[model samples]
Target chain A: SQTIHQWPATLVQPVGSPLSLECTVEGTSNPNLYWYRQAAGRGLQLLFYSVGIGQISSEVPQNLSASRPQDRQFILSSKKLLLSDSGFYLCAWSTTLNYGYTFGSGTRLTVV
Target chain B: AQTVTQSQPEMSVQEAETVTLSCTYDTSENNYYLFWYKQPPSRQMILVIRQEAYKQQNATENRFSVNFQKAAKSFSLKISDSQLGDTAMYFCAFLGDSNYQLIWGAGTKLIIKP
Candidate 1:
């Protein structure tokens, strides 16, 4: 059985603080990992996706960046967070596009 | 640019009744895929159904089914015997064969009342 773990669950930080959200998968190898953000009443926005370790493709240009330190570990980071960066962040993994993605529980970050 | 549209922002129905949610998309590419996802209070994105453009038959999963009209570029989800558990936000997504990412609609909030 495959499972994804994403943490802090929820966090509140001041603007200009550094941010790091981690996501890791268990029971799967070389799966495609993706980072997405959702704002209230808005659709999910794709931030970054990784095909392999250290191979990242970004969909949106912003203060956010992604890294795949391990085959199953994907990280989203921002050196200096902005107030507008506050939102619900989700991590998803997929073996192929024909099948739907398996998403993590998500992390809610409130930048005050 | 490709786009997905969910015309109905919200819908409400009683228990055991049937409800249909509408979705439409625009794409010049001939081969693509359509998906319907449910976001419950837990906020997990659950894939309810998926329709492949090459297939003419519609997709179904138990009480949930899709009415896919490729010519009209319309894909609608029909929920039968609706339950209170069905109350959540539903989103439609489009994935083109040549594109790596998905284009999602704003989303439709569905409320199943008792």
Candidate 2:
């Protein structure tokens, strides 16, 4: 079975600080990876998606960026964080033809 | 562009009762997919059910079922004998056969009172 792992389950970062959240998937290769953010009571907002290594498509212009350094490893980073950047971040993966996405446990970021 | 819509912002039902959450979507393509995902307090996305546009029969998984109306563009989820654990935010999603991207709706929060 395939599984996704996201780390620093909960993060507290000071304003203007650097941010890095890592996500890795095991048991799958060449999977489509995505990054999503959810506000307190709002719907999920797709931030970025990667089809292959070094290939990323960003959905929104914001303080965050994503990279697929390795086939199974995806990272979300920011040079300087903003207060508005605080929210729950989720990483998901799906097969080339599959319609459903399998999501990781999510990282809760609190920028103070 | 495809769009998903969940009309109910919140719904509450007593334990052991039945509840149906409504979801509708708009798309120009004929072949696509529909899905329901559940997010609990832990914020983990769980797949509830899925329906393919080409299939005429609705999909069912144990106590969970989906009513797929392709012409109406409606796909509703029905939870039988709801439990407290069923309380969560449900999101409706649409995926076209050509694109790997999924369009999600603003979720409907379901609360099951015990």
Candidate 3:
């Protein structure tokens, strides 16, 4: 079975600080990876998605960015965090087909 | 562009009761997929059910089922024998053949009261 691992389940960052949230999937190769953010008690918004390594398509252009450094590793990063950047970030992966996605546990970010 | 609409922002039902959450979508494509996902306080997304646009039969999983009306562009989820654990946020999502991204609805917060 495939499993997704996300680190720093909860993060507290000061404003203008750098941000890095990592996600990795085991037991799958060449999967489509995606980053989604959910505001407090709100719906999810797609931020970025990647079809393959070094290929990322951004949905909402903001301070956040995603990278697929390896086939199973995906990272969401920001050079400087903003107060608006605080939210719950999720990582998901799917196959080449339009099958549904398998999501990670998510990272809750609070920029104070 | 495809869009999903979940008009219900909140719903409440007594334990062991039944509840239906409504969802509707707009898409120009004939072949696509619709899904209902649950997010509990744990914040983990759990897939409840899915419906394929090409299929005529509605999809069901255990106590969960979907009333899919392709022509009407409606896909409602029915949860029977609801439990307190069912309290969570339910989101309706859509995926068309043209894109891999899932268009999401605003979600309906469902509460199962004891």
How much is the lDDT of residue A103 in candidate 1? 89
Q: Largest DockQ belongs to which candidate?
A: 2
Best by lDDT: 2
Please report, in order, the local distance difference test score of every candidate based on alpha carbons.
0.93, 0.94, 0.93
What tens digits encode model 3's per-residue C-alpha lDDT throughout B76-102? Answer: 999999999999999999999878899
Q: Write the per-residue lDDT of candidate 1 for residues A1-112, one digit (tens) a residue.
A: 9999999799999999999999999998999999999997778999999989999999889999999999999999999999999999999998777677888999999999
**Clash-forming residue pairs, model 2:** none
- Number of backbone clashes in candidate 1: 0
Tens digits of per-residue lDDT, candidate 2, A1-112, equal: 8999999899999999999999999999999999999999888999999989999999999999999999999999999999999999999999855459999999999999
How many angstroms is the interface RMSD of candidate 1?
1.0
Cα lDDT for residue B41, model 3? 96
Q: What share of the true interface contacts does candidate 1 keep?
A: 0.47
Candidate 2 residues lying further than 4 Å off, grouped into runs, are none
Tell me the TM-score of chain B in each candidate: 0.98, 0.99, 0.98
**Candidate with more favorable, higher DockQ: 1 or 3:** 3
Query: Candidate 1, what DockQ?
Result: 0.70
Q: How well is each residue in B1-114 modelled by candidate 2, as lDDT tens digits?
A: 899999999999999999999999999999999999999988899998899999999999999999999999999999999999999999999999998788999999999998
Better of 1 and 2 by DockQ: 2
